[model samples]
Target: MPVYKAPVEDTLFVLKDVLGIEKFNNLPGFADATGDMVDAIVGEAAKLAEEVLFPVNLSGDQEGCTRHDDGSVTTPKGFKEAYQTYREGGWIGLSVPEEFGGQGLPYVLHTAVGEYMSSANMALTMYPGLTSGAIAAILVHGSDEQKSTYLPKMVEGTWTGTMNLTEPHCGTDLGMLRTKAAPQPDGSYKISGQKIFISAGEHDMSENIIHLVLARIEGAPEGTKGISLFIVPKFILNADGTPGTRNGVSCGAIEHKMGIHGNATCVLNYDEATGYLIGAENKGLAAMFVMMNEARLGVGLQGLAISETAYQNAANYARERIQGRALTGPKAPDKKADPIIVHADIRRALLQMRAINEAGRAFSLYSALQSDIAHRSADPAERQKADDILSIMTPVLKGVMTDRGFENAVAAQQVYGGHGYIEEHGMSQYVRDARIAMIYEGANGVQAMDLVGRKLAANGGRAVMAVFKEIGDFCEENRADERLAPFTKALKKGLNDLQAATMWFMQNAMAKPDNAGAGATDYMHLFGLVIQGYMWGRTVKAVHALQDAGDSRTEFLANKLVTARFFMERLMPETALRKARIETGCDTVMALDAAAF
Candidate 1:
């Protein structure tokens, strides 16, 4: 069985030292988010994940989600009670606004909590995770009345929320969606559509499910411009804020997939469902983005979470699994053989997983911090800068973190050899679960295009330059620090590669439009590796600072430095291969004609 010991100490170090959780506590509306409060919240969350959720992860995959003939979807056994515990614990709305029934924690802290939840049971966690995204959409674009009607209950976990964007015919290409919303006699509209791959679309976990759906309104233009967002509830609410009549929404069926089977993926049928319009009539796609971005980041955290979980299990296995004798001879000659961890290759695999997981954790936290800065900063310019950087980095976090996360899981599983492929081992679940994150929330390919084509070009490349400047400033400040020497060098090389890739794409995109599409994915990953290298470099510097101050966390800090070195030496060099591919141009990818193959 896969083991999961919560990395609580490392998480605390990142929150308290690296991201300044204390400083966040002083921010408006977060006065109660002290170190003690954070510790208590993280500790409780870890316990639930490790004890309750982790135990069910294997069974969840084994049993999967069940679709009944009555059209009701049933998650695996224990999911209901587990969800209730999550709700009662106030985890569902940890980062939501205080006006609602949420705890209103900062995103940075929420990111840490999310990592723990996901690490334990990513499939089960999706029920609440998707609800958080739905809540975000309603809060951002819904009318005040809508917010009053939905926010509190959703935050309280009496009800849950979901994003309904995909359809039977349309997945990523929302422009082709045929879902329609027609005006009714009352203020609400009638929605008719068939949405597929809807995560948590229908479940027994909560009393009500509020779906943020996208459909074309009557007389709207063709394509994406004509699409709008609507609020479709599974059950209509009464004047007393209780579920009244059953809405027209129903789950046609549920999908049996490769992983995340603990979370229902429903085929929803909205046959003249009672719906309320959010934002303008034809601006639904834009409104849905608010939720999509949040979901994207959450998915990225899923990637990081599963990787960390896999690493923990694999590392523990390596320490105990006795195999062949070591190259230098068996350390336990009296025993049968040496542990697998005694071998250099096994050590390398474990280190690879550790380095990526640690860096990914820090990167996800940094993105969350930027989100807080964008939302809570006092100055307009500061907020704008935060927004710019966030817009650029969001895709990177989603695309790179998830891609690397899957790789890390595979590596960790590799450490187990034949046992990794066995169902009973539970290590393969990490790989299976991590795989979807890359394809969902906009495929990694789409993310790369957005990064290189749109975000990089935003404000004439100011966003990209700002990120580069921040890294440059950090290097200048820490150049003299002996502990940061290797990290700094790796970061600088990564930056150079990022800039060169950017220039190459921009210069060739006009001449060959396909060039951007062809090279976007590889380039996005290259950029992410470089950015993560910078984050690891900064982490090493921070750890060294803590050590110099005679802090008791020297061992922890030293481990972080060593992990940073591991990342620089083993992981970051993959960018060279990616850069070479990007430089090779679109000829290799697009060389063949339509019928050539």
Candidate 2:
């Protein structure tokens, strides 16, 4: 069976040592999240992941989801039961506020548990994953009545949620959407449209599915400017707040997808669905963007989760699969051949996977910590600062991590040779699953463009400059630390490359706009590499601190130092290539005429 175990120890170390999450206990919902309490919470989550979710991953991928004549969908055999257990355990509302039927924990804690569930089963975890983003959206922009009616049930997982933005004719261009919401006599709107790829759209796991739909109100202005958001449930609510009459929404068909089969991706038909407006009259895109942003971060987590699991399974296979004798000598004399792990080539792949994944984890956690600070900090400046950092990191985490995550999955598959290609081993599923993260939640290319176009100039470039300063500060502080000299030096070079790339874009993008578009992906990746390098530097610093304090995890810290060195010396050079690519402008890219191609 393809199995997974949460990297709990590493996670705890990052949470406590690297990020120093303890100082944030003064904030609301973090009072009880001390080191021991955090450990217990993660331990319980690990059990649920191992016992409940991990066992069904391969089966869920194989069986997929089934749609019925009545437009209801059924998940894989064990999925509904597992969801109930998740609901009962308060897992759905892990970080939600207590007033709304949640545990009232910090967002970072939720992220830790989310990573665990994601690694256990990306397909199954998505059923609840989309719901959390929906919850975030409603909490931020929903009306009082909407919150009272939706938050409690959704938080408890008795009812799930989904976002409906894409239409048959529109994908990235929401202005092209044709979905219409006509105002009703009783203050409800009648929604009519077709929405495709609506994940968890009509699942049997929940009593009702609340959809945050993007629709244009009748007679509203054209394009994205006229868009409006709505709360269109599968079943309309009764006077007592219980699910009552059936709504006009129904799934027309379930998509036959490449992966994430356990969660229903539906083609929804809304024929005059009774809907309630959210946010302003013609500003649906503004409201929906909140959920989209949250979903983007969640999608990035999918990338990290799949790569982590793929790495674990691949590492295990390498240790057990017998192959050619070691180049040096027969490491296993009794056996005809040594394990494949003894081969230097295989070791290279494994180390690359390890370095990227560990750094990805830190990148994710640090971003989540920023989110908590942004949302919960008492000081206005602190909140604004964290929010700025988060705005920049969001696309970086989504685009860069998904790209690297897909790469790692492919590399892990390569470790198994032909066996990896077969479905029985399940590596192919990871690849297919990871592929969607890059496309959805705004394609990685779009994410890159957003990073450079919108985020770079935001607040007079404060966010990007702050990140640059952070790297410079770390390098300055560690300049004389002989133990950390190599890693610091590499980080400095990566920072220089990143700054050069930024300067090139600023100077060239004005004369030729395509220069920015052509190099956006490369620039985003360059930024990702520098941020990951910073993550590793902080991780090494944390390890050294533990060692200096006479902590007993010396051997583990040594391995961590080795991985940090590998990332700095081996992987960090990619920034140079990326920067070089960025400086190449868009000559060849735009040189070809449409007819010539």
Candidate 3:
């Protein structure tokens, strides 16, 4: 069986040392997230992940989810029980507001521990993950009555939630959606439509499923402008706030997916279901995006989670699986042959995975901190800047992390050679699970287009420019420190490449839109390389600062320094290639005609 030990200490280092999360004590929840509290939370989360969730991962995947004749769904054995344990422990509402029966901790804390839970069991994690996103949308856009009716129970985890946006015909284009809502005399609406690929759509794990569905109100404008969001419950609530009448929604079928089988990806059919509108009429897309953006960030973290788990198993296998002798000599004379880890090639693969996972973790947490600041900071200027940074990081994080995440999972599998392909060893599961993150929560391609087409130019490019300045300032500030010179030097080069790519889009994409479309993916990656490099630079400074303060764990610090160096030396340079691809523009990409095939 695959084993996972959550990197609790490493997470602490990021939260406490690198990001200095305590400095934000003026923010609502930061004061409560003291060193001791943060440590205790993550440490407990590790126990739940390693001991509880991980033990059921392979079994959950193998058994999958089952749908009954009555439209009730049964998750794999132990899933319901595990979910109950998770709910009882209040894991679902770690960062939800106190008003809604949550702990009201900083969002970053929730994000930090989220990595562990996801790495342990991505499928199981989705159940609550989707709920968190729904809660966010409702919190932001729902009316007071809506919040009172839904937020508390959803936050408490008794009623899980799911986002229903994709219809049978529409995946990325909400304009093409046909789900319709008709107004009722009692201030409600009747929703009739079909939503496809709904994760956590229906299950026995929770009492009720709160689906945030996107539908067009009757007589509304056509396309996306007409779309409105609604709260379509599986079981209608009575006057006493208990589940009363059975609503007209049901799970029609379960999708036989490539991975995350434990999640009940469903075809949900709504036959004039009683619905309550969220936000204003014809503004559902804007409201649902509140959830979509949150889901996108969560999906990005899934990339890191899967990559981390895959790397752990692969590294362990490399240390034990005897294969070829090292080219240098027999490092293990007693063995039949030296372990695979003794070979430079295996070491290279392991280091790459390690470098990306660590930096990716830091990148994710840092972005989450920005979110906390954006939402909680006192000063308007500070909030705007932090929100800008968060906005800029969102697409890059989702696009680049999952893209690299899938690649790294494949790389990890390659390290295990043939054993990785077999199911028993469990590497294949990681690869399979990692695959979906790139495709869902707005496919990475769409994420890339969003970055270049919309995000880059939002508010006249304020967000992107602000990010560039932050990276540039970091590079300029640290380039002179001989100890930090290598990191800053490489990061500077990457920043330059990223800036040049942005300029390329400005100069070329406006005239020829396809130029942006052709090179958007590369530009997204270029931006990712720089941001992760910036993370490493910040990590190195923190490590050095800790060392100067007489902190122990010399070995751990040394390894971090080595990994950070590897990132700068090996991974950061990829920015140049991405920039080159972007500069090549749309000619060859768009030159092919419809008849070419």
Ranking by TM-score: 3, 2, 1
Top-lDDT structure, candidate number = 3
In the predicted model 3, the residue pairs found to clash are none
Give candidate 1's error at residue 572 in angstroms. 2.2
As a TM-score, model 3 comes out at: 0.99
After superposition, the stretches of candidate 1 with alpha carbons farther than 4 Å from their true spots are 24-26
lDDT of each: 0.88, 0.91, 0.93
RMSD of each: 1.3, 0.9, 0.7
Checking candidate 1 for backbone clashes, the offending pairs are 229-284
Model 1 TM-score relative to the real fold:
0.98
Model 1 Cα shift for residue 486 (angstroms): 2.1
Candidate 3, 184-241: lDDT as tens digits: 9999999999999999999999888899999999999998899999999989999989
lDDT tens readout by residue for model 2, 1-597: 577888998889889999999988878877879778899999999999999998888899999999888777888989998888888999889888888999888888888888889888888888888899899999999989889889999999999999999998899999999999999888899999999998888888999999999999989999989999999998898889899999999999999888888889999999999999999999889899899998998888888998999999899999999989999999999998999999999999999999999999999999999999999999998898899999999999999889988999999999999999999998999998989999998999999999999899888999998889888999999999998888899999999999999999889997889999999999999999999999999999999999999999888889999999999988999999999999999999999999998
By lDDT, the better pick of 2 and 3 is 3
Q: Residue 345 error for model 1, in Å?
A: 1.0
Candidate 3, lDDT over the whole model: 0.93
